[model samples]
Target: MTDGLTLRLKYLCGRYWRLLVPVLVLLSAIAFAGAAAGVTSDAQPQQTTVETDSMTVETTLSTEATVTGNTTLYEQNDTLTNLPVYLRSATPEVRLIAVTTTPPDRTVSVTQQIVLRLSATRNGEVFWRDSRVLAADSTNVTNGSTQTTATLDVQQLARERLAEVRAETGNVGTVRVEVETIAVYQTDAYSGRTSAATPVRVTERAYELETPQRDQQTNVTTEQQTAAGGAGGAGPLSVSNGPALRDLGAGLGGFVALGLAALVWLTSRRIGDFDTFRQRYERVRYAEWISRGSVPATGRHARVPVETLVDLVDIAIDSEKRVIYDVSKGVYAVVDENLMYEFRENNDGDMNEFGFVPITEPTESGSTEKTSSDDGAETAAAADSWFDADTEPPDHDSDASPDDGS
Candidate 1:
């Protein structure tokens, strides 16, 4: 029995040997592949970390400044307070007469007169100074007159003298005068009061001679000729009674008269035309027609009623009186004078006749019925009663004919 069992076991072992060999080979190949993969993973390259040095820098800046100034100028005198001394001439009619430190010539002394009065105040007391400085030509003077008069020629004085007077008196403000009086009255006197006079004016007196009269004999001759002409022959060719001159005069007069008539006729015609045009253009209907054609039809399918279209341009009614057009079927319509005046007085002169009115569609019976349904039962009954009263019932017995008559 042992021998038989050994034989069976050997047979079974031989049959399975082929399969076991392939299984063992596959296990060996998987082991080798796993080992190769493990080796490759472990031998892979690694990244390297490199080290570098860091650097820093510093800088500085500096600045400097310098200044210097020194100059000198001549100073002016402060004796005068620089206050303006307004110098005004005696009259605006006269120009500058003369300005001088010394007296002027004889030719310079006839045109203008300069007068001066001087007074002084020392401490708290007041005293009158030099009262008179007469003209070089004047001889009468014995003092105590508080006024001095000096005559000077306007064109004879040098310009330098005027400048010196202006600078000394500080008359840079304004210069004005009446006759010949001091412009600046000294309110505070004392500490060396001083003033220089500068004359300025316009001369108004006439210097030319009058026109001479003609001799009596010459005047008489001219008057006799003028009288003779006025007595009979008054115009050109009046003494000559020739046919040519008469005909020419008559023709000129006729031409002038005809020209005047023509002018009058033309002006009247123009005025009439303008009146007509204004009446036509100023009417509302005409203006609208010219600007837009006639009023549009009521709708795309609706025809505009002839009466309605005509009524659009027709005059409005107000009371029972009818205002008809003065001209029948005329394009231009003018308002009656009385009506125009009344409208002007009442409506502030506006002539607008045709005003705007809105167009609306008529309500349908179905809509009225729907509206009645929406209203409460009480309102519907009241509406029905009102409608029944407004409408009369048709007579049914009137349509029946009499039997005996038939």
Candidate 2:
């Protein structure tokens, strides 16, 4: 059984050697890709983080006010402190604070300040603006210090600015009023590294020129970032994961397989089936004599089968007739008196031949007379008579004859 299988395999390889070429090339490419992937995955660099000492500075903003009124909602000496919705009557005091933390055995000198600004904008453009340095301080710290505070009386400042702007413009039509505070901190570390932080708060309130109106809204404008710097006073450290081994292998295999598939396709296109090439070559060579149509089945003539198209053409030339080729049936024929000489390409060894015996009848002279039962007999007789007459045959001997060409 092994010997028989070996022989069968050898026969297939010999018969289809062209197909094996691309298969071998693909296998080689896959091997090379796998090796390359293994090497690259081994040599790939790993990610790691380095540790060192660093410093950080943190800051916050707050508010303080005394609420005094005769109404039930407002009481005397009632303090309104910290975040939003502070009563505009309280004359809210805005405070800025900062703190610094450093590594062990390190000291940092800090300078902090709070700044206040009052502005009015018309059509989104600032028309009147004023700024004041509400408070400033300096300190040195090894760990962190208590609250570094600077205060601004925002309600009083906004009231004064509103009166001034209204008086200058005669009427405040759709003018937006705003009060803002900025807390800034600068730090100088022992290693000569310096850093700064600026956090902002904005306050908007409704008011008349002479009276503080409804409650105020305060918002922290800066996106809070808790940590400032990386270790060793560098920028923030980052680490990323590299490609996994299995993923690398799969990607390499896919790329090589795609390339090999393309190669196989090109090879198959360039080197086509030998028999199909012969058929196309014959068609092109004999295109002048060949017409695309169906040939009728012969029943009144003896069939004489030939091997190639050249034999059929030779027979047609000798008989002084044109060749009829049926593309659907893959047949070429030339009809002479009682004989139909046929030629067909044996592509799969199962092509049918025109082999029907002639139809005959007894005449009164006791002799056999061959005849056709279809109306095609009249057409054939007319065509034969026309060919025999002075009507010239087709110009079958043109310079593009298949005899001297492919």
Candidate 3:
């Protein structure tokens, strides 16, 4: 098995050895590049995460209504939280609360400011409006939590304000009350390329009131708004060089290619030029005189061996006959009178051409016989001769006619 493999490899190298150097160089370079990439990836570990400073600020608004009168709809007094609707006859009292939150470690100080406004509008025109500062801004440097609160009689305020607008312009307008809260949070976290600004985040919360009157019931609706803010420095990077299997495959492929190149270089033997040159030159120059077939067994004739096709063709031209090339045996021959001239390729580099073979002369009955040197068989008397009608040779070359010998 190993010998067969070596022989095949040698044959391939003989046919394609010119490409070996360039292929080897290419594979070696690729192997080196793969090794470099692996080393680079190992030396510089991927940045999975970066140390970052960050702070988040969130504000929430909450409101509740309490019944301030003894009416048919309640006991002595009832306090309601987050009611879908409130009746004015119940004399509901409303309270608005705002809270701001931040991370504990990132918080330095936080302050909140609250403002409330009451307005009456008709056709997008505000004819009557009132505002009050419910809570002044105050900061607490110790903690991250801050809260602010305000209270008002929403029914009484809306009734009075709407009545004044109706009395002056004789127009019943919708009454709106709004409360806004602002909170500022201080932190040390910052992001960007410039000098870090005092990382300050501001958040707002709004609470609004709405009223709808029926035939016998007047309802008030409350709504709250939420806001958020944040500040942070640079964060981690998410990057990758793809799957490990792909890298391994590429590296191993480069190595395998290099190994193959080395094996071919070490074990291959190129075929020499002598046989190749002879086959090409003879096939082209003497194509017209050569005929491809099996050569018939000789009888009553002597064998005259030659060294090359040129010498064989010279004898064929003199004999006025065509040269017969036996493809299976790789022998070229010509038969004339009593001599069979022959030439064969010497692939083993042996230069000897002449071999002596004893032949018996024809007798009175025109019969001859010859014995093979190795097998001792009388093969020369086995059948009809090449000139006989039953043992005629193959057709001459396509370019030559019947009378165009040689």
Candidate 4:
């Protein structure tokens, strides 16, 4: 509007610009650090959760006995699970069925084995025990979708322990019949999974004493019974160890604040020199080595994020190789080859200091052109004439040497 107003405004800005510039810069840096930390903290856990879910497996013991019709599990994968373990009585005629159905991906042969262990205890003292690998037939899918079935007859097993097991039930206290059904599966991919059905109690029912029939009676060995009780099998399904997605989203707001504080510490604090970076990078490399699988491999010459590479010089020292930083590409490379191959004309000995000496040799390129006019005088004249336009000529009219021969 007015010249006086403009001049006063410009004077005020000029007087306090030095102080104003630093304040603006500090505020801007704080804002950037807060935004970046908040975004990264919120995003990382969600990505980790999705990856964990894909690799998780969960197995549980189903209580229901009625076989739901042939079900398709993991469509395309065509997962076929064996019958859930059931209560096996010593006396009663137990007819158990093991049906092997066709899975979608049966190009590879798969087999499932279910073992039933029976133990009868009187007053918490086990007197008799017997285990049988239930009759199971798992054939490779050769032609089309085919099914194989095997029925386990428990009557014969019961007859073997007729006297020992039945006598325990007639005792005064609670007679416990602990039946454990464990299933083992092998896939075509050479991987396997072992699952144990919850131990079913077959106690309350009375055992009917029938006429004794002669059969091969292999007395249950003492060690075999002990091994069966305190079994150290595969650990629980890994899927249970995965972090719950519901829990991942919790306290994200708090994490944002914590991450912002960390960002401030990293940004505002004085970043030490190359030696400091070198030490920090060495520590990071050691941490990566100790926890190998946790840190994914970064490809050659990849631009590392600030989160990964705290100080550039630290990475250079940790690698102990020639580190090349391309500011435009925003990537760093640790190379063993000499990079000054094209800069052979430098007279300074700096290149030699780095162990790069120019290798002078006959040119590999094709023959050079020969001049038609082989005249040295003409060549000299052409060189002088080329620079004649840019060079100033010496005036003959000025005092030439001392006007006369002194």
Candidate 5:
């Protein structure tokens, strides 16, 4: 039985071996492929999930400043007539007192006089204005011996006087105060001018008129009557029985007519005179004149061709030595020697061109021997021949000699 079982097992294992081997091989291959795929993927650049961020920011700030102080700018006698002139008494009561100042400790000390100006106005017109000096009394102050306060009584008297003046005028106005202190000198003590010091603070005040209400009303009524009178026959536009208007109109009309006549006369005279002058002066001709030495025998009565004359003139011949016979002035002067030479040379070839060289004077025949016409003709003919030459390619070699170059 054992023998039979073993044989049977061996037979079964042999039969299934093919299928089992193939199954194991397939499993190994699958594992290897998966590993290879993973390695390849790792080797390739990774698509990293790199997160990017963006943000906005802002900021703000501020600051502050401050200042403070108390200082004495200027000080004057309090009793001075600070009141408006119109409010001050008419009688000159307030006199300037001595001015003085205490020596300053922490700050500087300055003493100045306050100037007051008094004026009166009537019917909107200033009839009077006067400058009054008010000084300070400095009896108590040491060092600064020129400072003092004005008396109260005097100030009161000034106010009273101003009040009286205002009451009488019935048209009180404001008083202007201008204060300026200059350097004080011992020599200027007696001079009417103010001594030097710091400038004083200027102040102004207006004094009301004391006219009664009834009087004001009456004045208004009078003003209205005057205005009404001015608006009527006596007004600026009112026509009087005189001939002023008629005369003005007549004069204006006469002025207009005279202007028109003068304009027409000027226009006609300008046109007529221009036409007459144009007829008399319009002519075309050349002029040549000679002065100084008499004309040369060869050049006497030698009429320069218009072409030659033009050439001579282009050379700037001296007017005094030039003779113009073509028009206006006839043989009036001698021809410029330089201009004559230029003309002769231009007509004839240069001296070097001819075998006969130039001499200071004309040839014995009194004429240039060098003839330019033949040379000019030859040059012109050569130019024409060159222009007419054919532009075709030559039949000979380009580098050939003259006989062959042609």
Candidate 6:
């Protein structure tokens, strides 16, 4: 029943637009409200760009160069022949720095390696990185300039002559530290004027590297990161406010419509066509007249003989003072309810123009013989003797004059 109701509403919306317009609006409002609520809720949790610090050190270096000066090489620009512009980016400040010893903490270290790693941003583009306020400390900045030095830098096995020169220093247990800082080259050569080194943040261990001990029973606390308007998280969002007033209105409208349809169905049987409609209309009209104590009208007057209805049927008259029988209209054409012609008082009263004689009552059982009387005379006799059996002749008064016989 529910499904059928739904289908009926859909059909009515298609057929009766004037009636369903309000319902459509109500439904639309409900849907819109729900959508709006979802949209508003979706604006809360934003996923921050997550970055993991570099964990391992690498010794290899690129010879060609990676830094690019132009930002427009990303599209369909033919000027960039070496590599796609999107792939070319100027390395940003150190994004990750991690250090570890070959052996984790040790009381006696025979020989170990010091590994340092650094990761940088993909582009020199300045973008906000979500970061927690961990710690702040004072840093020593050296402002020194006007220095010239010529040095050759590479990694290779020490030659015999270089080994002898290093051996003269006689410094045992001392290791030379080499720094690898990312530099943006404005020109092709390693000259001092055209290149500038990007600032790097370096952190080193104060004590020998060791695996830190952890307290196993410690409890972890969580805090909500709230943005403006008390909303949490950051990202695209959706808002929905559930069913609105429009939805309720639509539901109410459907019920009202069904109620009206039910009323129409219950009042009468289905009328299939115009013929059925006409028949039903006539029956209702006739019934209405019967309820009001008037004769039911049948348009076609049946040519009923005056004797067939006897004195029970009402009579109509024409202009000639004679009774009229309309073959097409069964009802009498009497002008007023108080006016009608009486046929006879007897049950089988008069004969009609069609030679329809009323049958008189049979005589007493032994006297079945026919009477020598005209049909009209017998009718008058029956009318007079309805209760009395005999008819009396007129009597003359004794005071009559002698010429009265004349």
Judged by lDDT against the true structure, how good is candidate 3?
A: 0.51
Number of the top lDDT candidate:
3
Which tens-of-lDDT digit does each residue in 315-362 have in candidate 4? 545666333322112233333333210101122221111112212222
Better of 1 and 3 by TM-score: 3
As for lDDT, the candidate ahead, 1 or 4, is 4
183-275: candidate 2 lDDT, tens digit per residue: 333345223322232222324642222111112122222332223222222222222213333435555665666575565554444434544
TM-score of predicted structure 4:
0.28
Q: Which scores higher on TM-score, 2 or 5?
A: 2
What are the runs in model 2 whose C-alpha is more than 4 Å off?
1-20, 23-27, 30-34, 37-56, 74-76, 90-106, 150-155, 158-161, 171-406
- Record all residue pairs in model 3 with backbone atoms less than 3 Å apart, i.e. clashing: none
| Backbone-clash count (model 5) | 44
lDDT of 6: 0.27
> Estimated TM-score per prediction?
0.15, 0.42, 0.42, 0.28, 0.18, 0.17
Model 6: per-residue Cα lDDT over 199-314, one tens digit each: 21212211111111111111123444444321333233212212233334444565555555554443223222323223222222222121111122323333222432212123
Residue 52, model 5, lDDT: 42
TM-score of 1: 0.15
Off by over 4 Å in 6: 1-240, 245-250, 266-406
Give the Cα lDDT of each candidate: 0.27, 0.47, 0.51, 0.33, 0.32, 0.27
Candidate numbers, best TM-score first, in rank order: 2, 3, 4, 5, 6, 1
Better of 4 and 5 by TM-score: 4
Provide the global lDDT of candidate 2 against the true structure.
0.47
Higher-lDDT candidate among 1 and 3? Answer: 3
Tens digit per residue, CA lDDT, model 1, 1-406: 4533433333333344445445545555554555444334333432333333211111111111111112122122212111122111211111212221111111111112244323333443444233433232222212211222343332222233333443554622322222232211111111111123422332232111111111110001111222222222333235352432443454455455445444444433433333222232233222232111112212322332222222323433322222222111111221222332010112211111121111121222223212232334453343233222222222112122322111
RMSD of each: 52.1, 17.0, 17.7, 32.1, 46.7, 27.7
Ranking by lDDT: 3, 2, 4, 5, 6, 1
